[model samples]
Target: MPREHPLLPIVSLPFRRAGRDPMTCRYRCANSCAHPEPNASSTPYFGEILERSLSRRGVARAGALGLLVVGTAASTAGPAAAAPAAPPSGTTSTSGGRPGRPLPFEAVPPNTIDAVVTPPGYQHAVVVKWGDPILPGAPEWDLHRQTAEAQEQQFGYNNDYLAMLPLGTGGRRALLVGNHEYANPELMFPGYTGIPDAAQTAVMFASAGMFVVEIEQVERTGQWRLVRSGQRPYNRRITTTNTVFELTGPAAGSALLRTAADPAGRWVRGTQANCSGGVTPWGTVLSGEENFHFAFVGADEAPESMKPALRRYGFDTANRGGPSAELIDERFDLARHPHEANRFGWIVEVDPFDRASVPRKHTALGRFKHEGAATVISRGGHAVVYSGDDERFEYIYKFVSQGRMDRAKSRAARQRNMTLLASGTLYVAAFDATSAAEIDGSGTLPADGAFNGRGRWIPLASDTTSFVPGMTVAEVLVNTRLAADAVGATKMDRPEDIEPSPVTGKVYCALTNNSRRGADANPPADEVNPRNANRHGHIVEIAEDRGDHTATTFVWSVPVVCGDPQDPSTYFSGYDKSAVSPISCPDNLTFDSTGNLWIATDSAYALGGNDGLFAMPLAGPETGHVKQFLSVPVGAECCGPVISSDGRSCFVAVQHPGEITNSTVENPGSRWPDGDFGKPGIVVTWRPDGRRIGA
Candidate 1:
């Protein structure tokens, strides 16, 4: 029989040693529990576990659950039929799929320990890079001839998130917004040392980080290219020194947001370390501020009372000085700018359609180490956004707007739609399992057939109200973790990317590996995280009641437990273990037109292979046929696997190229898309015959 739920040990069953292979034991237990009539409280949880186990055994939940529920009904009605065959690979159809054409690339290149390269019949290009020009009369980039003033107007380094939105007319032009993540002085500056003053003032300026450039796109032969020169009217640059963003939502003008520069909390100087982001249906761009902890210092010396909130947010509780005190910018010294850290870690929204629009930082989303935000339009027309805090033991959050969506697709409607995100209610998830209470640290199946349960979205704050008893709405948004703590929200294992399955409207979250899971004396195993030392990670599926994205309660399950298929703890919706690609450290996620989920990996453990992108169907007979679509080279993470609206092209960002140890420009380990040296860049892949990608 399946084991007990992790959290409630009282419901657990004794684990048996079934030979050397754990997969066999897991499989056998699931198959044996095909038909179980547990109590009502445990039925739902058991059903989820059973479904997961059967899925790993290659049995569809509908078929397995139907058999369990109806029993001899099928036999009485008619003779049992053979199980349906799995769909042929590459047979799925997406929006751009058409007849009589081959796929973009037959398959991605084999796993590599180095940098990025595309399959044959595909080409990659660097649209823009650090120090590139974005505004009129901007000076060309000169690494050796650098100045902070010039760097302020030039493109920033380490572009993470990218969004391209169309401008007036039939897609002839567009605006591209790119986030400048943390600066890599060693990689960006020549002859760089820890010294504050470098040979290149421009490099120092670039290191502060900023958003730059709006390139005009020229419609080419069915593709788009950046126009080097033109009437570029909407082009603008937002840098670390001069750009001002307004505070909105719950934390706007709160005391926590106050700084020497903005005592009233109305404005902040600039955005920093922006990671991944989303584009709203209303044409605005949402950028997530991540890893803002390293930008400020001096928390260690602050009063003891402030330490709790700082520690929760990953800020230094011991020393307050940023990541590296000696090498960091002087501005990060908390003694110099006590409130600098508070200015970051927010979801900043920019109206790309309006050049003069001042971006607003929405506090309702609750600040932490934000990875990204993905929104799903609720059945009731409200927008529901899912976000993750990329720190171990952090929590996942969702925001549901009170305003309904305007179905009209007109420009005026789009303008109004952008405001939906600014006013919303934020919630954190808390999961509960129903099962035998005997399951302990071991990764075992629960008696209820699954490590599944129902969960509630505990509200933290709304437009003008706060659900947190003692804290104000501003406190709830600014120091969100404290608020979540008060409400006892369930902590998760590094929630990375939370996205909705376009086909089913069910949400999928990547709970990236957490070494701290099942730590000797910390937060122990829970239903959501069934494994003790969760090293390989898993995928969480949340289905809102009646398919309502704004629902307060929902059912959840772990569909895919990522690891080597040979490992018994790993599960893949019952697909043949040998037939699927081994995956780990799932981070960013996107969906193809055919409703297939594409997952991107960041850090790989077990030295299994290179980080890459994997695709699996969320519906149909081949729902769990996970396959490796692409891989990145050494020292790089596969990010931004966004398929085009037409499905004809797939774009991925190969970040931190040539990031291997003890390697420099003179002796780079991998010279990727460019032969001379490797530079992190965005790659586009399309069929040679111009057919839909992934066919």
Candidate 2:
């Protein structure tokens, strides 16, 4: 038996507040849920595979015709996103089903807690909060007296997507890189109404970007703190207000990317709306620019030829009257600078070790509403990156660098490896389920006992080369979503952070909930996404062909269909339902040293509880056993989960606490960590005895 935790009670609220707060939907993602899905292409779902598979010879012949030839203008005519003809039909395999190690900690129960809840043996601390003074000579944070200059020197708001890279040996020091995804003006400004003034807007822009701070481990424990002492050279702030980022790759100097300010199109001012990211093997970081469509105005008045690409990227073209960043920067006004919108939405690379290093945006990675960039080394020594376009009925993407990684430790070698992402071939995913005939959109398991499938990576573009027939290299890179749609890629349900396990090369993606799944002509439920009106999303496991990261073909299966275990719709890799904890809305994903999957949740209140972090063994007897490791504060979503290389500390970014509708700084809904206001911050959790996490 477990003792009851003395915290906030589990209050029953209406289903409306269960998922995302209306205020969060507006501020975080520009009320994206309220708008129609940008991807309106007539792409076929997995159910079409059954109809095509009736004739093996015809299916094989069509599969070959479906794949677009890379490095050339070879292409397909219609909606035929089939697999390569060489692979066998319905070929799939499963892993991690045997007996293995058991989870040691007890699960935490769901609650509307105003504090961070952890398993009994584990402990947690607030590592750093938003608006803390990170740079030297920076004044303390005062919500009422905030200025853009002061905020530029302080830690920004809404810390998300955190990673701690080793600074030196012995784990005593490390560098922490995090993203300030977006700003919540209602929560930041006291007595705030709608549409902030120039000063307030400037402060908000200054608060949104990326941050790098030096952190030191405490006494060999998992606890770490920001270095507030002498000569912290690594403490730098890259905000949307002033940071200059360089443009790289084939699309860098294209006419579409050029603007009146530069004309050269070789440089950009800043990176905004950075979500989740991954630390690369070459000792740098790659952050994705997400939800950038909300930052611009005058798109309705843009050039006639540009309206299609703009609307396809979620731009509000019909509404010309709205307050946006155009007031601060003319580049945001698409009517005056239609080409400026093309500059953002690329993968940004930052070298944290060099203080004077100018960050670069790689154009080879197709531009979209990127969730994050996770990289792995392929069997053929190429750099493979996986990213998700986070929107309803969007597609997943991959990039394979043509250049091999330089393994030498010299600075010259590091500089050479930095250019790896600048030239790569971009591909999109298309799935074909084996059990398509049994999918009834009711979350029922097929006769094969699992939702498994076969899939392929459809090439879209390469460096200075166009695989898409009509689009040029620059057009394919800038208008990537359009090219993917042209190639008939599979539309997924808000694919978020995608990661490849360090222990196993298998890739895992969090297909976060899509309320519109099967609702009114949206893509119906298939094997991978096995639920209709999927409130609690599921996890996907993909094994590349021949264990090669750059392979075009792969096998996939849904290991966990997250929801209440009592619900017949939920599936947990054949685990005992009574033994697993309920999980909803899986978002960010990471892995432990032993290959256990650590999942961070966003908008998990759909299950009538606060969002939380969960751990599930990927293989063995406990493979599908889900355990709740920690629960965030009320009205908050968990993001940017990273485990230390030593396997002792786990870091999570708590974002947008106390963001309930109509709540302001004057009367906040939940006061967490500081007892005064709800501030988004990074937290570190570990065992008191300093044992390996989840040991």
Candidate 3:
């Protein structure tokens, strides 16, 4: 295949999308859980102080899966059965088998090491990694002499969320955008020096952001390499140290976002803590800035009235020890610059095709710890985006754009359509348990026997109106969780990644474990979050009324209560309890073209093993059959799993391998993919025979 002109670089264009509505397609909101989970693959973010307000805690151990859950049903039996992908529509058995003739592969047990473990017939490789040159004129990586200038042009650190959109609609070339959630200084720097000098801190600042690059498939093979043509035009990096982002929606110029530098509050210097994100039909990528407040300290000297809001956001003025960000950037000292914290936690949008375009933060979608955004078109053509606040006890939200998706691919048309998210109606979820009284604060089924419910998307604010009394439209968008609280949204068990099924039009959310369930250190178990002190979380499946993407009313049920099946508390779509792979702490989620749901786990609590990826059929005979496709290294959390357009290759971002107690660059626990210092990167796994991934 012949390649066209090299892709253009990311140019920064400025346009306020607030009123730009010309029937162009619009985008939606998304967020990622930037703050690392306890003893997670990375370091601290907002940390546990926020846990107080979050009012939550426990996860199942990674190993000892069966020991944790005792007396339920055995999942790993003596022999195994063939599990095949159920036909998109058919009458297949829940325990799928036989018709296709052979099973894909048996589920692999959890292991502790540093390798991209895959099925026998599959092959894998590292695509792009930290320190690799991505832009023109970038110097080769030199660990001993690292600098912000060099880090800016190289791949940013801690690759988390990623999106691969076809380049020019061609199958051979595609653009990949990955979110560098945050930098692991200990792992990056040679001697493991703490954040001390300005030079080193600048490196940290430059590494914590996002990077966009183009990739091409090898001649007639599944292997893809970074397009190495003259200065990759589309290759660029958006970092906390330099790139500028424009704020959109109701809160664009709000006083709360105004800083000494950006008094207009319409633009911020950069986006930090970007986590898992989504792709829009209009051809742009959406990234969620999560726990951006982690880098700052709360304002103790601010007006008393503003204290509660600051604390609610996990901001505290107390200096915990060691070199602090406040020493370098005053904006981190909330007492000196309080509003700077408000500028983050919004779903940010970027146009991958045009490097010159400015990234945008859609404030209409509210501010919170976002797990990221996923969108689906409504029956009426409206763009409906789904996002979950990654904090435990927070709520899941959806934004319905006023305008419909404009399939026109012209540059002008796409620009106009991108503003759809800038102005829309945002709603929070509220669940009504069918069996309200049966919940006895234990991880038990209600009188109705299942943790099922009827729920409604409570409208919190529209682009122009605020449903919450006393708050303005702008205020509602900025203080979304407060507005959600005021309107009685359901407090979930650490709502994480959520997505709508392309084939079924149903929405699924990963409620990462909230140790604070029944006696959750706070609220008791509700029908939606039924487990008491839920160690292993569950998957909540939502079906909008009449399959409408923007439907206000919906029905929901717990499809998979995760944990060791032997433990009496687990549930897996009521399928044979003995047949499912044990999974816990579901984080990022995505479905293949065939409609099979692929789940990436953040915490392997139940099995005491490395976190891994699981594939479950969402329709027909294999609806609840969960199979472990692959597992990451010893301490890495699997993230950003996206299937190539052809469905022949699946790429998963292995974040922070070798992250463990006492593990650092000098003393690595796992030097995976490359045996040296631990680095976060993406890995592509494909079948040797060119079959579909997970086949």
lDDT (Cα atoms) of all candidates against the true structure: 0.60, 0.80, 0.69
Please identify model 1 stretches exceeding 4 Å from their true place. Answer: 1-110, 119-123, 168-173, 195-224, 320-331, 409-412, 434-450, 605-608
Q: Where does model 3 exceed 4 Å of error?
A: 1-103, 317-322, 447-449
lDDT ranking, best first = 2, 3, 1
TM-score of each: 0.80, 0.92, 0.84
- Predicted structure 2: clash tally: 2
Q: Best candidate per TM-score, number? A: 2
How does residue 394 of candidate 2 score in lDDT?
Answer: 91
| Model 2 CA lDDT for position 665 | 91
- Encode model 3's per-residue lDDT on 1-695: one tens digit a residue: 11112211111111112111111001011111222222111211122223321342122111100100000000001100111111111111122221211126678676654577876777778888888888988899888999989999898777888787665434677778879887666667778654457677788778888888988887646667787568677888998868889899888898988989899999987888888888765656788887676666546665577766765665553433224456557777667777887888989988766788898989988898887888666778788889998776778999999887654545566666678898889999977655556565566775445666567899989977899999998888888877888877777887888876554466788997876544413566766787777767888888787878888988777878888777778877666768888887788887655556778987673456668888876555566778888888755779888766566778889887665545567877567756675677888877778886766
Which candidate wins on lDDT? 2
- Distance from true position, residue 407, model 2, in Å? 1.4
Model 3 gets an lDDT of 0.69
What does the lDDT read for residue 314 in candidate 1? 61
Q: RMSD for each model, in Å, please?
A: 13.1, 7.9, 12.5
lDDT score for residue 200 of model 3: 78
Please give the range of 10 consecutive residues that has the lowest summed lDDT in model 2.
Answer: 68-77
